[model samples]
Target: MRLEQITYFLSVAEHGNITAAAKSLYISQPALSKQITLLEQEVGLPLFERQARGVVLTQAGVQFQKDLQNILKELEHAKKNAVLAGRAQKPLLNIGCFDGSYADDFLPSVYDYLKEAASGQKLVIHKCNFLEGHEYLEKGKIDLWLTLAPSWQDRPGFLKKKIAWRKGALIYSEKLQVGKKENPTWEDFKDETCVLVKKSQNPGMFQHTLDTMELIRLDEGTIEVVENIGTQISYVKLGRGYCFLSENIIHGSKGLRCISLPGERGIEVVAVWSEKNAAVTNLMENYPI
Candidate 1:
């Protein structure tokens, strides 16, 4: 069916009255009715049933409308993106990030690179959590995802590159001498309650450290687990307990003592993108970090 016919059909379906649809479309009711009738003939089925008060979509019309709506949305998105791509001197760059350590380690380099490459193009950086970033990437809404989460081996048609890895340390109040930095152990916290950042699907570098170290004997009954990092840090700052964080995070945070564990691996930073986004990824990769 023609786009006009689809538009007429959708308008009528929305208004539930041919007169109202015709008014909204700036067309006469006869013209609107003629188009709807032609559309029904083309499909060889009645699309709507008229009632005294209004109209309702037939079973076939209901299914057809659902599919048509999806098609229309995709077509509109493609048109918009095409227009944006055509007008740009440089490609539009949309980057999604989770938290601060990434901002500290990789962002400066990525920013400088984009500036040199985008010379005149638009750059959009959205600071969002993992779930939101992943959703945006899957929906073709973003060009790059820089995060501290592990690579997804099962996900297809994506490029995953490791930028850097750094060990993590438990940070506590420097004012308190609860344990020595050289040999900080669980034994040090035998009777003391410690603060922990809540578990998450897309954990940062310090996630594994927290998971491995605390799993053995975490008196879950005693551990104060807060979902927000800001709250976790605040509790640790008050000397209520200590929390795990990447060395990079430690460097950025103030008034905290970073105690390294003897045998733990640091967090890993990765740059991920869809295969279709190679141009943007290459632009990011070749740019100096």
Candidate 2:
């Protein structure tokens, strides 16, 4: 009728004596005998034949013991598998990247580091624009964000760490020879069209570009905003404009010449997440910049 009754019945059946079975179960012989009597009454069959020396199993009792042993074995198997399944369910680490191009340079190293450092955990990645990444982080869709340090980095409830600084550079067409100098300042491209991605895609980078342009005293209409990176690169390759990009992004491209920006003012690439994420905190602490 109950699991404890079944267990008690099995123990009595195994020992062939109520006194020995009660000793094994750490209970009184009368208590063990009472449980077996209750089990026999529930099953509506006599489970034992009384003898002076001990007890012998009735025909029904032998069959019942065989069936109960199989049932107990299955219960044990299920419990073990449940424990194994719990262990196999690894913690997920969802990471956000600003763009596919950023992932191309950044994710491989990060994936490798996490694979070794946080073994048995799952890793998931999403590539989206900076604003979308920020939204994902705020809404709990992503656990970490990799992007340029934004204006809100120092705000409360967020944690931001600078992992690396990528130097800024100008990507211009080879045909447009603005200067023979290997490294040029923003002043060198005063007359050139400054093609840029949409400000909404990356407001922080856009503000930085605006600040640099202001420092050079460039005219207001000199900047051109495009919808995407491919369009910006196309404009530069056609000698129609030049664009500011991190050196890491434009490296090894064939048609464009990358001239470094002056003063070594590099863009800070950061890892950001909510301060409430203990997993993110552990990751930052383990993998320090």
Instruction: Give TM-scores for every candidate, taking all chains together and pairing residue i with residue i.
Output: 0.58, 0.62
lDDT (0-100) at residue 69 of candidate 2? 90
The lDDT per prediction is 0.71, 0.76
- Clash pairs (backbone) in predicted model 1: 166-266, 167-266, 205-267
User: Model 2, 1-289: lDDT tens per residue?
Assistant: 8889989989888999889999999999998888888888988999998899888899999999999997896586457545655666887677877664644666677677777777767776666676767877898877888887743446789988777777877778766667445766567777778887788776777788777667556656388898766677777777888877777766666667776667876677788889999877877777756
Q: What's the residue-level lDDT of 20 in candidate 2?
A: 93
Give the Å error, residue 63, model 2.
73
RMSD for each of the candidates: 10.5, 23.8
Residue-by-residue lDDT tens digits, candidate 1, 1-289: 8998889999999989999999999999999999999999999999999999879999999998888887796587567667777886666777777754435776777677777776776776767666667877888777888776552332788777776666766667754456434555556655556666555634542356456465545444257777556677778777787766665666655666776655755666677889887676677567443
